[model samples]
Target: MLLASIIMHAAQPIRKERSAASIYHLLQGKRSAQTLQDAHMYGLTHLFGIYPKLSRQLFDQVAASVMNEAERYENQDIPYFEGMTYQTQTESFLYRLLLLIQLLSNHVREEKRYIPVTDNPAVKHWIKQWYRQEQHRLDDWRNAIYKELYDLLGKLPPLQAALFVDRLTGYQHIGLTPGQLAGKYNIHETDVLLYQTSTVHHLLHHAENKAAIFPYLAALTNQPVHKTRTITSTAQKTRTMLERGLTLDQIAAVRGLTENTIKDHIVEMAWLDGEELSRRFLSDTDASIILECAAGAGTKKLKQIHALLDGKYNYFQIRLALALRRGHGVEA
Candidate 1:
């Protein structure tokens, strides 16, 4: 129900304007220019890439069931989901925390051997390095971690906190799997996953913002913990070319892509880099006209805006302008 609710909430803003698959792609964190653009345009950036492994069959089923009752799933205050900003580091951060907890649990019992919670080599390597560094001060490390987690989890809702705590593999207590958690809580496995994700995201937010309070916890993540938004790699390449003063046609030829593809990259960059690049494809006056048309027509639909302008601006131009408008947070 929580996963469905989140999907339904994301669908509402772009209902009927975009296909169901678009929402699926958005949740899956497709790196396409279109998906990224849709996220910014529809104000779904926070939810973007929240569930990268969502199965298509499940999404279609949930999407079909909730299409008519989207309003019923409206969440006035959805839990913290800065997927766009935090997706890259969330899993690694969680892995480090879990592995650290498991290590601490066993170390306290003077146990040298225990199956690890995560098989990821990178996580294991990081944990090993950290343990070696703090070996002599293991007790202090453990106490600090406990204090940090106690204060941090206290800030979360009870259920979310439980989900986080239940996933930890302590000395004698094996952590619960998502399936086990689902059965225990009587919610769908997917909801359990999402709840766990929400809990981790909340903790990550606190760690990044309140570094003083969560020093050890914050130090667990090896990945950059800043909240910087990013663009797709392909679009990033296009941005590099643009910086070199290459025209759209020249870029297409050099990159072996169509001019239209190049234009798409440009628009994607506009969404991230703002009017600085969008104005290259669309002029200020033309963009103003497009924004006015969008405001007057009460839509960001490119065709409608193009038609409103009597086909004076091509779809690409109108799209570029709308990207700027959305980037600038222009009213309407």
Candidate 2:
């Protein structure tokens, strides 16, 4: 139900402009310009990249059921997700927490031999470093971690908290796999993943925002929350050329890409850096006209906006204008 609600929420805004596959790509973290533009254009940025490992088969099944019962999944308040900001951090944070819990649990029981929960060399290496620094104070570290988790998990829904706790491989207890969790809760396997994701995101948000209150948990975060979204590497190159006063056509020629591809890069940069770069492509007056036309038409379709304007502005101008409408100003 949670995954369905998320899909339905994302689908409602872009139903007229894009297909269901677009949303799948966004959730899978495609990192393509089209998916990135779709996220910002449809106000689905918060849901972007939330499920990178999502299967196409599962998504199709859920999306099909959701479209038939679309009205049932509206108005869901998904406050726990900040996928665009935390996409790189969520899984790493969870892995660290799980490993730490297992290590602490086994250490307290004086258990000398046990298999690690994860075979990730990086995670194991990081834990080894962390353990060495705090080995002499394992009891204090254990108590602190318990308190931090207790406080953080207390803020989540009961079911979500259980989903998180049940995944921890501690002491003699082995963590339940997602399939096992699905069967135990009588829900779809996807729901198990979503519930756990929501829980972790919630923990991350609190740890970052309420750091003073969650010192130990906050310290576990490997990266800071992003203040602005990032554009693709290819887009960054285009930005470098644009910054050097190169026209789009010239940049396209120089970079061996079509003019259309360069424009896509500009649009992506507009999504991330806002009006600072997009304004160079279109005048403020024209942008204002496009914004007004879009608002009047109640649509973000560039074709509709262009027709409404009697084709006075080109498609690129219309697109640039719309991208700038919700843009952030030059940051200090």
Candidate 3:
């Protein structure tokens, strides 16, 4: 039987489920007058899916939408007034249209939909509270993702860090496209795409559970204590070097890497360790100034933070202060 038949046979209310196709599909596209019908059958969404759970509802929605489109096209295709001068889509054209509908349905499967809500006081308060929690959760996942991608980039030979930063920051901050990045960085377009793909692959390789983040970190963090120490020794060494009063420049020289690389090691470590180390190296006076500057700048980049402070703090002090705040778990 068609999977759609099975769903009808079971006659169960379906919600979210687990499957490979997108749950976001039905939320998109032109639903027309078919939406209500689509919402009921559910199987239409999963014509090609395994709707074992929450995803079953998602698949059903898709199946309904696809079938509706097919029905609409078929009903409108030809008229029955024998000699009337009317035109209709060709059979092949209709056939191809249905194919396009199925293909396009999956186009936005990877994206997430926004919650449908309004500003009722209780609803708003609930949403705000929920957002605070989700923001923290998403932030954690984003951080882990950034770390894993960066760790892979860090392993690359000379200029890897610069390349990663330039590509990502420039694209995100400066709005540079892949083609533009190629021109700006003196590299090939293919290399840019390949690098992006490799980074994503690396991220997926360290899969926590699936999607962009949620499950992956969830799974990883579930591991034992020893497994949680995923950070590299370079960060630990940088911490020791800093504690021993080796300046960034000195540490860079000793490690045979750039000053920026050393700084990255420190900042990332600070983020990982949280505020535990902040009180040790940060004086209350400098801490206040750093936090103030961080609030004004709203960023952690050394150059950006220094500029925001109008040059009162030196490079090493700024690096430490920023790391201190980051370690202290104060995002601002």
- Give the candidates in order of TM-score, highest first: 1, 2, 3
- Residues forming the 10-long window of minimal summed lDDT in candidate 3: 78-87
TM-score of each: 0.94, 0.93, 0.28
Best-fitting candidate, measured by TM-score? 1
Residues 1-332, candidate 2: write the lDDT tens digits: 88889998888778767888999998888899989888878877778888899999989999999878877887775547878877878888888889988999999999968999999998898899998898998898799889989988888888778877888898899999999988887888888887787788888888889888887777778754454456788988998999899997899999999999999998888877777887688878888888888877778877888899999999888878777754321111
Please, what are the lDDT tens digits per residue for candidate 3 over residues 218-316?
A: 332223332342234676788889889898789999999898777656545544464565555557688689767766755545577677778877665
Cα deviation of 105, candidate 1, in Å:
1.4
* Backbone clashes, each candidate: 0, 0, 23
lDDT of each: 0.83, 0.83, 0.42
lDDT of 3 at 311: 84
lDDT of 1 by residue, 135-191 (tens): 998898899999988987888888888887898997878999999988887889998
TM-score of 1: 0.94
Q: Which is better, 1 or 3, measured by TM-score?
A: 1
Worst 10 residues of 1 by lDDT: 221-230
